[model samples]
Target: MTRPDANPAPDADAARLAALGYTSEFRRDMSLWANFSLGFTYLSPVVGIYTLFAVSLALGGPPMFWSLAVVGAGQFLVALVFGEIVSQYPLAGGVYPWARRLWGRRWAWMTGWVYLVALLVTIASVSYGAGPFLARLLGFEAGPASTTGCALAVIAVALALNLAGTKWLAWAAIIGFSAELLGALVVGGWLLIAERHHGLGVLFDAFGAGSGSGYLGAFLAAGLIGIFQYYGFEACGDVAEEVPDPTRRIPKAMRMTIYIGGAAAMFVCLALLLAVEDYGAVIGGADTDPVTTVLTEAFGPVGMKVVLGIVLISFVSCALSLQAAASRLLYSYARDGMIAGSRLLRTFLPHRHVPPYTLAVAAAVPALVVLCSLLSTDALTKIISFATLGIYLGFQMVVLAALRARLKGWRPSGAFTLGRWGLPVTIGALVYGVLAIATMAWPRTPEAPWYDDYIVALSGAVVIGLGVLYLVTARPYERGDAPAGDAVPGGPAAAGTAPSSEPSTRRRP
Candidate 1:
């Protein structure tokens, strides 16, 4: 792809700079550790532990590990594609901003709004999830009041961190991330040593010994569950603007995260599998909290309590990072005038040199969604998954668009292009994306619940319907291009060019 001139004229320079930060100059404050850690913490084994349970119950058992590998392979391809685009266009707007550059403003607006909604939904899920863990730690049930209180608290903490600026957030992430990493290793190591008699070979062979489906299917199903555990790491890309030289640094961080996080998750999955003496009981979906169930069985109440403590920490960290990602996404859409309350959502406090108000709004919206879910307990999981799947689908669309641009001869200005690996990787990611979407709509249970089977499609339709309404009512008000903000020369969104992959817009703060 031919690159756009960073700042072709004085007027262009001013406009681009204005897009960086509304109230202050753009500052790339995130480091390698922070970027990678942010992703790592969100996808740690603790989070994976729960995901494994969900997936196991959904698509058989143990085979979830094999499917985990499949999804990882799929994510690997998409990451490669992301590496290429992000290296070329490293802006905070992430997938949508990239889209704007390749496509045009209108489509970019649509993409950003859809993505923002999806991110908000994800935040609600994560925040909601933190409640039960916190409640359990405090020796209480995950009642509505408990869940809502925890959710609100988590959002409040995230808002505070963002208000403190990128350095503070990075430091907080580093500390939390370190704790999570060590916690996983400690817990997983203990589980392994306790069950060492099972033999290393058992980890590979224990899959279908009694499941009646044979080893292949059992392992595949287990892998599927394992896959969802690692799904949230890609949120790293959304925080690109915070990192210095993001085009170069973010890709490196993302790659490192995949390696470290993938190994860590796989190791934990193995530990859990080996530790469970009875696959039938462990995988029987007793309480839908297999990790806790396994620990309670293995080490009794004391051991169970310790493990729960670690899980609580992990949940808090994951919720924080997730909330941060959601805020950035909302901020990006608001900067482009895509959201309903665009002006308020676009505010940046000069004292904090961050969008404190916008961050608050972002956090509150998701919490409200969670509060709304309290009234419909039955639909909570389905609704959250449905919305999250829509966001993931949007991610796939953006990557495909980027790939198509490359195929049509859009070469990168930077040295980080995927080179010979682009087509194969892009194709794999797209294929996986389609499969994932299909799986969501698939009838997982023999007798599927009405909402479980169709929620993703239904919720996705509603999100799109809202987008259509905005297109008709708000499109004219959205400037053909984003308003001015602080930007650097040779930045991600190059001004004054017809982008090849996304909407042609310059810089998003």
Candidate 2:
């Protein structure tokens, strides 16, 4: 088939079409189930497990389980907002395009910048966390060096599979995601048996290892962190353009993904609480890898090894999803001229119908991040977390802005409508977003030697700084006369204009 923007006379036009996923080069022919399967397979219960450890340690024990619940509820609300927008504007650019249509390009650029950084750091952090799981499974030491190597190896394999085109990534996600879910259920059941014999008193006890001074606030923050585990499920929406019946299927898939993943996570978290040996040991203790201790306490050596295997597989799946998400993000940004070397980064391999250059560019930073773990593990982890949270903040802003637009009588018909629930859900997401940001900086101690709060703050600043840099360097690329959603059906070019996909209302550039 001829590409949409293909020009037999010009290589430049052909390259442009290929960059936009219009070229026959890297086009994927996977069935809808394959794409949906990829989503289900990439998102597993282990994400909830790993994130639960982070929140529990930060906010204290048992109480942290409630935090996960809260995070899930808050995310449900936010997901509603996204569901509406995605159904109406289901495209590859995802949030950026939605925000640009509702808000403006300058703001959209900034939003995309932050989201891109968030996606990048997410990939890096998963890579870092994958190492310990592999080492434990293999009965090898899981130091910084070993973990880094394992992460790099996973990234290498996943990248290669992704470069093979959509089918391989889809199947890999299915296998990896399925194993993680089953393993989580097995571990949860083991913990449940342990809980039943031990009694349910600890389940009701709000007490934890913290000072009990600000338990509510701490739990709230912990829940936010837990919700972060289920973060990338929205990547399903980002790739909607590639999916068949995307307007109807993507939002449905998203709802199912979140609820299924959340329910599985909740069961495991409750079981983990019952099986916990030392609340203080798992909480106030500075162990980033609480899963190891939790499993060991519940199932002995055999259980610990099994849980480790599940976690390793989970991370591998997450790494694959992350890489896939990042490539699409880069491709989206480049197609819109938001990034440097738009033509090159957007180039697709016609034979495979894939964005090979975008994949290469996306993988470069993460590989560096994984390698840098050898130098300073603590620093890398802190920075990655900071970056992830910062992106979450940006997402919050965009959702609220779009919600506000809807409230002002701006309605677009789509498959997923928030309906009467729109205002309340949007409000809830905004409130939770504010609280989450505030709590992300907590447990700060002057004497702790290293503070993640400062790192998070600095990372946020750098993200904004990059946006500023883009504005300064790419001002000429900004199209001031682009139409809004109502003005163009397909995009800017559809309105008989120069196809300025930039946010049309903003003039700061």
Candidate 3:
């Protein structure tokens, strides 16, 4: 691989990738802001909070806003640790590539497998979430047919955006980020200042008493609302090979993505919670969709429709970013002859250098998953829950892999080193990740079907089980390039062009 700490000129990112053993294929054209835009849009504060706000509020009332803060702090640790790791590796495939370099082939393959499923399910979930709003905008009944049709339409549009190539993606991301931020800022500010329904004390009122398990259960359920919001920061790292000065720029972009996206999420959620004319009505589930009800009241019918249109744009950007990230992850594995049909899947377009086959697979699978939405409401819920669990597991794998690697004498390289803070932060991230996973997978609602109760664990087992099955049965060929850990044998650095992987003695702030 390229020297972990090396920073070549703007045009040298590709040359550095070649030194790492692959040819220069991608355009490497995304600017730093474009990278951040992609991450922000993928995180999509408006989409995540807006979609889940009612459930969260119903579960924990106004105190649900506090859960966002807790999740945000925990996720910030994960993001900080990832920033350091991505700086050292700075490869495509995000968690998959990072895991491969930190652990080994089986680990990387499994990580990518989990994350790929997560991304596809994420695509489906985002599209499905958009369905109701789109239905509202179009004056449809939001039945199974309408929602499924809306999801398919979203998938088609996102596919077109992906096929247009990375430059178009960057522009879409920038536009989407601007619109989401504007929506969050403008809508949230208006809500906060326009009408005062309650005081700030509502935020501290733990309405968890309604749950039989007390405040703890309600808080845990609400925490799930924020778990999926913080992940897209890694989307920046997924396309690291295409970003100039990736080691420096990508790491910073990841951290900033979290900071900016988290702020927007909290701002909007708090705004909505405070803006609702009747907090009691929302907590009581008075309106089937409290967010829409509150927004429609706050902005009136026609005005709320316009706001929904902005939210629709945010969803489009979110889906586009998810598809792009997923395709890059597929290409990352295929680049090293790891995935099935490697030759075809890894093929980049002749001029654009985008991986068309991977993109097709990425788009097609999600469109298919949307069909599950047509099955029944239960199926759709389970499917979206599948995405939430798979993604969190993938994240924890990377955190665990980093922790294990550090114990094995791995010292990260790059200008963005964590220095003396590395071990503590990495450990904190791991602890938080494990706890978050446990909270999400705890079978919190026993009244739901056993399948729904343990949905995360069940879906997680299936995905990981399939990955293990493939690795064991096929005995697929592993390549000399893209080995599992740092200091890959015979890589460019090993050819004496740069210093060997360093001992873990130095400290940097």
- Best-performing candidate as measured by TM-score: 3
Cα lDDT of candidate 3 equals: 0.80
Candidate 2 residue-wise lDDT, 1-509, digit = tens: 11133212334333433333232233334444555545554455675466446555546556666666777777777767777777666556567766766665666677777887777777777777677778778889888888888878878877887888776776777778678778878878877875443456775565565465556655555554465555655777667555655555667666766777778877877776676665665565565555666677667888677677777777777777777877877776666566667668767776565688878766778888778667774744474467557657776867766766766666656656777767777888889777766666554544555644466666677778877887788662364333333312344432234534433212221
The CA-based lDDT of model 1 is what? 0.64
Can you write out model 1's per-residue Cα lDDT over 1-509, one digit (the tens) per residue?
22343423434323333343332233556777888888887666566555445446334544455555667677777777777777766666677766765555556666776777876776676677777766776778778878888877776777777678777778777877887778778877888887543665653554433355455444443444544555555667777766655656677777777778888777777677667655555555444565666677666877667777777667666766776776776667766666666567666766555666667766788878887877866534654566656666777877767666666666654536666767777888888888776665554334677755566677887888988787888663244344221122233342443223333222232
Tell me the TM-score of model 2: 0.84
Stretches of candidate 1 above 4 Å error? 1-26, 51-59, 196-224, 282-287, 297-306, 377-380, 446-449, 476-509
lDDT of 3 by residue, 166-193 (tens): 8988899999999999988999999889
Worst 10 residues of 3 by lDDT: 500-509
- Assess the local accuracy of residue 424 in candidate 2 as a C-alpha lDDT between 0 and 100: 77
TM-score per candidate, chains pooled: 0.83, 0.84, 0.92
**Whole-model alpha-carbon lDDT for candidate 2:** 0.64
- What range of 10 consecutive residues in model 1 has the weakest lDDT sum? 483-492
What are the Cα lDDT values of the candidates? 0.64, 0.64, 0.80
Tell me the TM-score of model 1: 0.83
Evaluated at residue 122, the lDDT of candidate 3 is 95
Ranking by TM-score: 3, 2, 1
